[model samples]
Target: MALGTNTGGGGVGAGTEVPALSGAPLLGSLHDLKSDSLGTYLRAQQRHGDVVRVSAGPPGMRADLYCVFSPEGVQQVLASEAANFRKDNAFYQEVRESFGNGLLTSQDEDYLRQRRLVQPLFTRRRVDGYAGAVAAETASVVTAWEEALDGVVDVSDEMTHLALRAVARILFGTDVEATAEVVARCFPVITEYVLRRGYSPANIPRSWPTPGNRRAAAAMDELYGVCDRIIGQRRRAGADASGEDLLTLLAAARSPDDGGFDAAELRDQVLIFLLAGHETTATSLCFALHLLARHPEQQDRAREEITRVLGGRPAQARDLERLPYLSQVVKEAMRLYPAAPVIGRKAVAATRIGGHAVPAGADVILAPWVTHRRPEHWPDPDRFDPERFTPEAEAGRPRYAWFPFGGGPRACIGQHFSMLESVVALAMILRAYSFEAVDTEIPVGAGITLRTEGPARCRIRRLDGPVGPR
Candidate 1:
């Protein structure tokens, strides 16, 4: 078996043309996609069923997008017949050119080799060891929120900040403070740059002196500069720094056939981790808190479990299992607002999916955002009910029905870490404050990851006096 696939999956298409969404003859669905990609995806699935073919761009460069919304199809594309589809899409190309071909964008032998060398750095035990750091970072955010001039706080921005601090602390260790400013500043610029370019049909040359191009070039230079400086510092520090943190580990990890990640590869890995590690977890935490704010009953239940498990003390790694209700809340949030709302791949060979014939060299999308809301698996799928995730309820559904971290060999490597961070941070936050959502609904847009176009403001009342245990 290949590294990133599974044996079980849905059947191929019966070699028939899937449904094609009606759109402008030349432009196709370009305008709708630019305005709202996720919304468009849901509408497509609702209108045309599970498999639909969409075309975007002008006549010459038209992109035929095969959207797979069924869980069975998702399993086949991401896991079972994974090799038939690959990350050979425009979005990935944009990311690779800007960010370097790190783990997130690498493929085949390169991907396998990168996975083998970096896998040990992200093992569950190693990630669990960072629980204290996650908690401490959560405490810092809780403090900032507690001291907000008004009782209200922006849950989205604060969670993003907290996630960044936590990952940087775990990745860079003592030098986290040194690198935080640049990482914080440059990532957004780069993120916006990648998004604008990734979806644009024009595919402008990066070397062109456009204003957006200049800004992105500057951001990448600064981000790379800071990362290289820190990496160099660790290299000079030698063996003592090797296993102390993720960066150092990247510096030292070697394979039988390879010496280790050279300087450029090391920077690429760090960039991917920082980008994936922070934004993905931040999206989950932000939504979970906002969801709890809206649903007071569920919020209180999660808090009661957190209080029962940790009382006034800090939440550690083991507390994740103890706070099952809190975990459910997080899981539900991820299901509703998956970080990677739409994942894209290119069909490498002719394939059948959901009874539609997908020609070789076509673009394919696996949508967790749409699939998670399938009524068959989730009753009243739009509701914020944590009960949907209970073990018994979860077991009754298809495995690919709720894949937030993706599936198969190419699943998000940092999934366990992301979950741990969400649970621990959520436990600590709920223990500190009670949230009442000030914003009724938040509209989301996906760039590289899920992002809120509006604020996730909440009125948070302090539930505890001091930062320490109750």
Candidate 2:
């Protein structure tokens, strides 16, 4: 409990010791840290040893915080002893209010059943089916950019638009133009309320008449109305067997034991897809573009690889295997600026992590933001270095050293789809334009997904001539 005193190392063997911090602060001061939450945690790790404790919020509602810096400690939390943790109750409690029993927020049997039904839809073969749609969408977006008048463009906003459109097409077979508009209008409300709930837990009572809460309620209603209409039309048209779009797949997905998703469950799942399918990918795409703009050498290298693979044509799924460097760029970007920086869990039972005893009901926080950039695992962790992810380099590191999508059975189910979309989109954008960041510092804001605090202003002009191949 003393600040700066080393807590005895938690693990059994030598070097596995959790270094104690003497008189280390229990929680970090939000004001002094970088706006980026992950950066803040990483800074905390520097001052407090790897397994520092944190005071949650106000007294009486306080929760225990555990920051896992070592790969072994992270693997133990995420993989080896996964069941000891559940999605942080406070976080999921808010998600349940909006998403119901959707896979992202659900736990235990409900989570397992939903995951099983949805897993097949993301298989290599199934996700590969989305290649054409992904490429076409990327092409369409790039074409628009190519035609734009010369000026500064907010690539973050643009990528958000593109990602939502792409996910919409993959999920419901709707065109980007239509779904993007709907998502744009509804997203702010969802984001605002979720953040408010996260920060001020006591203000989330159902009976609260706050304007933000009311707006959130209204947005949910509008979203549900849209989803219901979509579902109704699909059912009435007897389109259940027509295609493998997520809607059709979910409409037909049955729990082998129990029938299929009930009316409410189906609605929740669709909402989850609409939100998770788009938001996280959009954040990642924005950050990737932001990184690319700042690191022109890395950007040019990725573009070179893309051109070598596909010439001047659009990239396809088949090309992903050949575009290892481009994939590594995306992976590195996610490592530095993961869409979801912090993943939390609540102990369902008493557990020991990093050799420290965690009592039942204790809140456990695992931040990829802190772990991914730890200097111990990554050299010059802040630098934009894609080489670290190359096959040889990756093989040398522990599995949990760079978990942006998360790890274990509860990892992001749409990870494969997201990766494919990012690679193709990166290829399209690089082929069309050369982008540069307007400033050295790109501000990040964290909501349901991590995003730029303001527009990621960049100068995007059509490339004057063909760049050489990879």
Candidate 3:
């Protein structure tokens, strides 16, 4: 089925009700839903067509939410009528403590203003320039893995470390490792706390001195301390006008209308960047490597391509276009396991998605996790097939069918930066090492991002000699 039955623009007609997916009258689907929410949503979508209404929260206070699994329904909410959707949903409420009014949590004019300010920092040329830095950081990670090749290495941990280093290099030019350690230490705590609260029926007010709340507060404080110290140092040294690192550019940036970011605003933006910048790409790379490890034929094919294209040199920005198979592998991995598995938006005004009425303040979830696996859109939905992303194949699919980075204007600002980072990092690492999956089946769970339940272990064996012509 493609989305809803009706294609008309106006909201679902009066008396026409989109059937609700069966659940406990009071508890609804709450019992069935677990940390592996992606699996729950996928099963629900298979049973109940495109749009399924489900209940959440505790008994009397249960909240009704809609999950849109159809590409057309997703497109309507994310692109066509996006103005009716706001970012201040339950999820954002949980995250606001950490994100503040930064781009990720802010809505309306504040969001637009911040977007304008940060826009210049991620231009095509600017992101391309970071390829050299990304390549260098990725090489450092591969070299470090040389000693641990004899034991099972946690690709998840390694990717997280590598991604943190890459983003830190891009954000803070000099003290990269030290800055990344601070981010690595605090981000997991803050993100986990926020996600735990987002799903809880009874909420603990942040002001309360509960132990969990206190721990979350301390993490936030440490995060702020680190951001403050670095930004303070940059300000004291005078902003580097020509510098390409995010800190320098943000510190130097002065909007013609609203002026520059104040201390608090700087902290908020940096927190969002630090948390979001590394985490999504890390999750993507982890999944990509895991998938490649499981499919040795595909891994060998990728290695062959890398050898042909790169000779023995580390992957650079110019080499990206030539490595089509590597790009497909990454894209397909994201299709199977999108980092941001579930995206939530609240309706600001009564509207419709797929002709189903959505009341104001109601939360609508668009899950790439569900849509990407919908059997109607993807044949053999569970199969690991990178060929699905080939140019000709992609040309036949719906536009919103594979939006791992999301869609429309509110989509991830760092999409280009992320793609470049993944492609470069994967190429550099794959060329130098061959990974064997230690566990064929790894459990999936949802925290702030899609994650593995335990460490995704892989055995690595280094390729003899250099990978390409340097």
Candidate 4:
């Protein structure tokens, strides 16, 4: 809980100095943060309140991170005073260089333009159109599980492949199989490179003859090459998208002010889509299943909901709203294990947060991993109780209390798409099989997205006959 008094004003108020972390003399909190950042942030909040000042690196190259953990403080930084905080920080700049100025890392006028051009493609109605693709890909995965029957399956890796194929299918209608293979082979390398350089106080240029740099460049080359080649072919052939797939829509997407995305711009958008679309949804689905496996009663309850709503039929997009309990289970899983756990921003100017003064130029972090575990809003914060997300309970809490997809203006553009995919896939899987966790815990860390450091294996048994009404 926060050890500070509330200020009822909207504008920045007279604030006191932020409490600093008492870490090692030389490296400060760098070692702990690098090793177990999620745990370190939770400990910092418990010890120093919501707004803690954590300093890292040596004297001259020091980086001061102002971590805002409270729901109110998060709201202030990400929503209320959003203009005062920008994504042009060191991490974001590195991401932009690696990923191109796509929606994820673009800023100012560029962000505004990209948002307008891409927003329509992700509208609730538009994303619903891709449900069949999600269902088709998920069926392929579940059917293959027959080989692992009465045995264990790698849930994490399976979902990663499933989501990759699902998203690839949506993006490239008939070109999915090839693109999915190229992405599965190369994305991990690029993601690792971004995380390695994004955190280091100093960086070696990628153009230098370093092994890591060379690997990252080569991975980027393959990914970029595949996307550009496909897009080039599409443009050359003059094939109109015609609502069949996302790539065509994106290719055909036009901005009222400047028209459609150029060739390089097309590549940037596709890269961001692949990165965000597959990674985060896979994390959510993997953990949701794991958590359900750990709690049999909860798993049974969720399966009941799925059976009642789906009734032995494969899940469709329209079935999302009907499976309320299933949604809660996924929501609870996300709260416990968010894919984008840590987010970074730069202060545009000096501001006050949680009654603490923040410097003009500082690395500010909003941690959903810590905030979601705050005991004040969520009792027994570590438990896997889906009841906490009941509409009544949710309405009673602050809006930012459980923001897995982030909040405000720059929140994830694919928010709707992620939830749709997760729910549809989970409904079908639970209806098909009952899971028992082979590994109760899987160690995970935040990279560009959450990366599972350990195996997430679960035992499965096909449900007898039909799981529910025929």
Candidate 5:
């Protein structure tokens, strides 16, 4: 399989099609893709090699997909020659129904403009400042857990709440406990509807009065209504509004080309930030804690590092560098279960990948969940080992091999923020509590992000002092 150079942004029909992974007649692989997306991708890659054409969607009429699982293929689709690939695919088009033209769903010029506008919000200094908020939120959750010591807790749910609160504090500059509660209730509805549309080959239009669509519409209304209330209240407060939050910044920012983000655009970006921001980070943290619980030795190693570094003090932004093992644990957990498991892009121009012809309008899937676990890139791919992410070990691997936050120019803008938040949260939690895995079998599911099928249950024990020995 030879790599193809980008041949300008021009559309061309697929020259030589790759072999197809056989699935049910007419349905093709849609059911498999929707049912067990992770298993389907891994199985396809194992059977058909790295790049296989997936015959999904309607019987014909250009519903073919090229699933790319190799690191080289991932780099091509996500980074190099990314301009030829667009987010204007079926999945993203449906996502835009709820997300609007936010960074997650927007493409091309609009995407570039949005990226430029929002990038500054996540600069190193800005993300560094968020560490304090992340630590504080984690500490708050820890305090709550202290009351419930010896009780079983849903780690996933708690992480979700913690993430929402942290993002609320960082992005809104005020506590949105009430708003977060509303989102926590309604966002799942939006996720359920959007996930169905994203994975299903034949999706009912949102305009149709289907029961699912009706529920989705109501959920969007409620979710957006919450945003409206927050923004509305801020507007009413005017000068009293916190001048440093992302919402305030967006309200003030104006673009010469598009005249800046209007009310609708503001709502879209804020909703995306609130929804995407909390969920992915929460998912990653949940998996990290679950992994640590499963491996007590590794957990002890991390806790020991945190105890020695802080010497009984809570984790803060300045203490990150001193906590290398904790960082490795976070990276390894993300490798096993990347938050954004699959990245989808549609080809706007004709291209060749792995010596096979890829035509315009083909949906390209770059799945880290599959690629990260590839034996070539990772040894004992299923094992939970943080040593793989050590500085010495990471230098030998490809940049895209373990991208939990993604890669390339269009990689997650909140990558730094997520990492800082996760590490700080993990360190703080380890300082106060040690989790024991209550459910040995944790089921994986696919939604907006890779998610747990049910609440990841863990037994919590509050630590009296240092995690090591006494």
Candidate 6:
């Protein structure tokens, strides 16, 4: 896919482009780095400082993309002057078609109203209430792993299944195994379409009836059908009288004007929650596990902490507070491999970002991939060091320098839930097994989220008894 276009403007500054290194283009090939979007952005930054314009779309039909990597620029895009940006674009339109107008893609009054309705479900207190469910679902998955013995397993698939199950149960109060099958059938279509749209604008036409497009359309239909059935069942049974799960809360939610989501709106919200809530968290855990396998010392330290806290038993939400180091590991893993590595917005009006005159309609890409790896913001940014997130160390940096879950009003609503889920799952898995990465190059894959290209193959050894020292 062509990277993005460079609309009607001469390059901003002749001096801004980094000198060619080893004859490589200052801006790398988007297709060559298709599997690793973050790596492409990082390479661009290495060659072209904080801002680089890249070509997107087919030759002669591309748009100009302005990538902002500086900390000040990232902050401006995410928080300051956020109102000057909107999510209505080719990229988000694909998302809307797949997930409907849910929290992830809905804009304007619709977005605001839906956000208000769904906000309460993710409030700190309410999320805390779902901790038991998270632990239960994670333990259930781990129990199944135990049955497999200490053999090699695809940790990536396992984590994806585990996260999808947890989200399904908590959001819809549904069976994990059944919902997982549905998600499995649905996710590939969602991801494939997301990638196709990102790579080529022409691939987005709903009227196109190509094989890939047909499969994607079918997958979306299946997903929505499942969601519709679940909603109908809940409504008929009146299962959410108290509004515990997110679906229940959304069902009972009322807008500021006393208007509530209709059946279709509720379905959209549920679909977004089911897909976004689980997929991104699953990606993070898979990467975290891989990182842990690579860093035995850190993994051992985290294991020791987990064992000390839970005594080789299941973890609880309360245990999260005491597992600070484990949290650091997760934070560090996300820093290196953020699931949503790049976030984009279009300038609705003329604006100044990091002192650069951003013309109206210009595409502004805020790459967490580049920002997180910045040498000035992170000491030895490439190394896998969780200490960078310790309260003391983190206090010294800019707040926007490390937004794994993004920032501002549009930030992920399930941030706390995802963090708690990762910490618990990491603690549990570490306590049960010591893992090592199989000696092989694990290629990176990028779609709407980042993932391993092949199996995240790893060898696992059972820890010394359940109650032994971690």
Question: Which candidate wins on lDDT?
Answer: 1
Q: Quick one: how many clashes does candidate 6 have?
A: 10
Tell me the spans in candidate 6 whose CA falls farther than 4 Å from its real position.
1-36, 238-243, 255-258, 439-441, 465-470
Off by over 4 Å in 2: 1-36, 147-149, 175-178, 239-241, 464-470
Each prediction's whole-model lDDT (CA): 0.86, 0.72, 0.81, 0.85, 0.80, 0.76
The segments of candidate 5 whose C-alpha lies over 4 angstroms from its true place after superposition are 1-16, 58-62, 236-240, 255-259, 466-470
Query: Which residue ranges in model 3 land beyond 4 Å of their true spot?
Result: 1-15, 239-243, 467-470
Ranked by lDDT, top first:
1, 4, 3, 5, 6, 2
- For model 1, what is the alpha-carbon lDDT of residue 375? 89
Clashes of 4: 0
lDDT of 3 at 286: 96
Better of 4 and 5 by TM-score: 4
Q: Please provide, for model 2 over 35-143, each residue's C-alpha lDDT reduced to its tens digit, 9 standing for 90 to 100.
A: 3455556666788756765543334443345556667777777788888777755666777787677988888888888888878778988898887887777777766
Residues 277-394 of candidate 4: C-alpha lDDT, one tens digit per residue: 9999999999999999899999999988888877767788898899899999989989999989998887767788877988776678889999999999999999999999899999
Better of 3 and 5 by TM-score: 3
Q: State in Å the error of residue 393, model 6.
A: 0.6
Deviation from truth (RMSD, Å), model 3: 3.9
Give the per-residue Cα lDDT of candidate 6 at 267: 89
Distance from true location, Cα of 145 in model 5, Å: 1.4
Lowest-sum lDDT 10-residue window in model 6:
14-23
lDDT of 6 by residue, 1-470 (tens): 22344445533332333222122244234454454556766777888777675544445565656678887877777788788777755677777878889988888888888777777778878887777777777776666776664578788888988888888888877545566688888888787877677666355467689888788888888888888877776566564366466777777777558488777888888888887888899988998898889889999899888878888566777877899999999999899888888888877776665555666676777888779998888978879999998999999999888888888879998899889989988887788788899844567755777767788878887776552212
Q: TM-score, each model?
A: 0.95, 0.89, 0.94, 0.95, 0.92, 0.91
Q: What is the lDDT of residue 302 in candidate 3?
A: 92
Candidate 5, residues 1-470, lDDT tens digits: the string is: 00112222345555566778898876777677767878888888989887887765554432567888888888888889888887767677767887677988887788888887777777888778878777777777877876674578889989999999889887677646767777888888887777777665456568999899899898888888878877776666666665677788777666676567767888989988987899999988999999998889999999899888988666777777889999999889899988888888878777888777777766777888899999998988999999998899999998878777777878889887888888889988887788889987788876778888876889988888633212
**Could you tell me the lDDT of residue 191 within candidate 1?**
85
- In the range 308-427, model 3's lDDT, one tens digit per residue, is 998777788877789999999999999998988888877666666666776666667788988998776789998999999899999999999998888887989999888899999998
